[model samples]
Target: MTGDAEPASDERTPGRRRLARTVLTGAAALGAGLVSGPGPAPTATGSAGAASSDATRRRPAGPDTALRELAEGNRRWRTLHERHPDETSTVRRALLGGQHPFAVVLGCVDSRVPPELVFDQGLGDLLTVRSAGEVLDEAVLGSIAYGVLELDIPLVVVLGHQSCGAVSAAVHADLTGTELPAHMQYLVDRIRPAIDPKLRGDARVDAAITANVLLVRALLAAEPELAARIAAGRLAVVGARYELGTQWVHRIG
Candidate 1:
């Protein structure tokens, strides 16, 4: 019995040693940036499992993967399955070292359409920029450029939402020829070109909303900094719309 036990113990010792070596090798790889760490893990909750599924998924390395992450997040949000991942103290502290956000979301400043909530992404997952009616200014453009040029974020999503007050206001001003207040007029002026004078009512407003998104996307894509990345296929620019009623976000451009 002792002789049989000795052989079994010897066999197990080598297996354990091999397992330890493998673990150490993997750890070294992670430390060296040769392997990416898993995304944030979520706390336990009924709806968290689905949201947290993304946390376990690999980090998005390019535009396509980043867009897919956003789509999945939006689905979880619309389905009432938001995981709200990566808001933990640990995740926050870890981010102090640096942020590695994969995408830039440029959306409306409307309180109801916060890009983070609409996409169901937590902190450090997205670099978000907002303006009324999704209008772009020099500052806003610079911010987006920083995300792409400095941060090397791969995807830029120009997000427009339904019933956007800014767009509606712009459309109303266009139809009536009533000038909005100075600053507000700036927003209107930016959005005015996209409005179709022939269309009226909700249809006009809706078309303007989508057109604004496309316009912003085009401007970003044409920027010298962003254009190079697009030409190299290292980046993508997309336009999407968020429905207030359904909480659904669909690409329009």
Candidate 2:
């Protein structure tokens, strides 16, 4: 992937155009801060499937700022006061040019943890990738690299949630020693390192969940491109836990 920064902007990006799930309407105000993307965007809920969306402002200046923005958003979400920052028509038209997302969030495929809604971000504001248990392989790595190396995003967040199906399945498979289905075995094997042989019940699942997030976060941080950026203090890799019980996002690493 090549950097999509325009001549006039210090940073910019045009993501893979994947459909993102929309939790709240009008939260796509992604153009106000700095990031840009082609919008009016589309949420994962259209007439046939995903719906169309307008963009909004609330651009974060850099990595630290981006993290802060996410934390505050999560607070709003936790308290049920989500401002739903950037989902307006003006925000939509503004991003017609490109995107300059401040952060790249690697989250789970769990529907409840949609990064945009969990962090209260909007259109063009985030470059997000999802996989069961937040697993990392070639394609996932490429997506993260594209956002960091090519798109100039300064932060990468590995977000794991409570009672993750992937993690729970992995734990169950490990305990029962039952082989999972063809494709699912791939995920089960990948999450093995995060399992705790001594733990059981919710504790076991939770342990693996956190372990998986840290594992992925470390993997991304150590990657050649991200490592160099980290060495230069230009990029940061973090791990976070999104709680379904209270709609809170906690920094784990």
Candidate 3:
């Protein structure tokens, strides 16, 4: 991770190439016969099948492909047409060799809004990071950077949701000036600035949730590690909000 004050605009192309090689080596070792399952037996070294699968999977998804896949998957989810791709033993075995997930989702730590479920993607398909209110922190930023910079994931989605408890709490605190507990207060403090002081109740919380997603998206787009990729058209950062009742995710930003 680079300094938060400015984008790390130094020449990263050569370094990215080096990192790709390193990841290939590390992935091979990590994937060999380490997976636990009732499925296919593991070979002493990895099977040729896994290698082939890895090769096919390693083709980096472009931003448009990534977005289209997610939108199609979400449609399946909301329509109860989910195919639940990639959960099979074969897919798991292939993943033992390496993961080439297409997107990075920075979403709330809310139970109802699991990224995999919302997008209807299976294992090894997404690199997901979560926090209450999707707050930005060093760890979260580093995780996202690893996916975009190392894994070469092309899409990053900042996922917010309706009736978010974190944003609701922040709205409550802002309206009444009632301080939350120390740790929870940390989440509120991070979220408070995104809320509109004039809006009240549900409207305030709903607007704040969308604002928070945009805020995180902006922060990511400005990040040195990610910004260069965006400029080169190698990566995209988007904002979306999930409706719990309809089980649909709508692009908000």
TM-score of each: 0.79, 0.77, 0.76
**Best-matching candidate per TM-score:** 1
Q: What is candidate 3's lDDT per residue for 1-253, written digit by digit as tens?
A: 1111211222111100011211112112112211111222223323454444533444336876777677666766766666566766777787899988999999999999999999878789999999999999889999999999899998888899878999998888878899898789888888876787766656677788878776777777778777777777788787777777666565645
Instruction: List ranges where model 1 is wrong by over 4 Å.
Output: 1-57
lDDT of 2 by residue, 1-253 (tens): 1112322322221111111221111112222222221122223232222123333234666666776677666655555555554566666677788778888989999998999988777777789999999999899999999998888887788899877999999999999998998799999999998887777677777788877776777667667777777767677787777767656566655
* Candidates 2 and 3, the one with greater lDDT: 3
After superposition, the stretches of candidate 2 with alpha carbons farther than 4 Å from their true spots are 1-58
lDDT (tens digit, per residue) of candidate 1 on 1-253? 0011111111111100011211211111111211122233333355445444544546689876777678767766766667786776566777899988898999888899988888778879899999998899999999998998899998888898878899999999989999997699999999987787777678788778877776777777777777777777788877777778766666655
TM-score result, candidate 1: 0.79
Q: What lDDT would each prediction earn against the true structure? A: 0.71, 0.69, 0.71
- In order, how many clashes per candidate? 0, 28, 3
Clashing pairs in 1: none
For model 3, the superposed segments whose C-alpha errors exceed 4 Å read 1-60
Minimum summed lDDT over a 10-residue window in model 2 is located at: 16-25
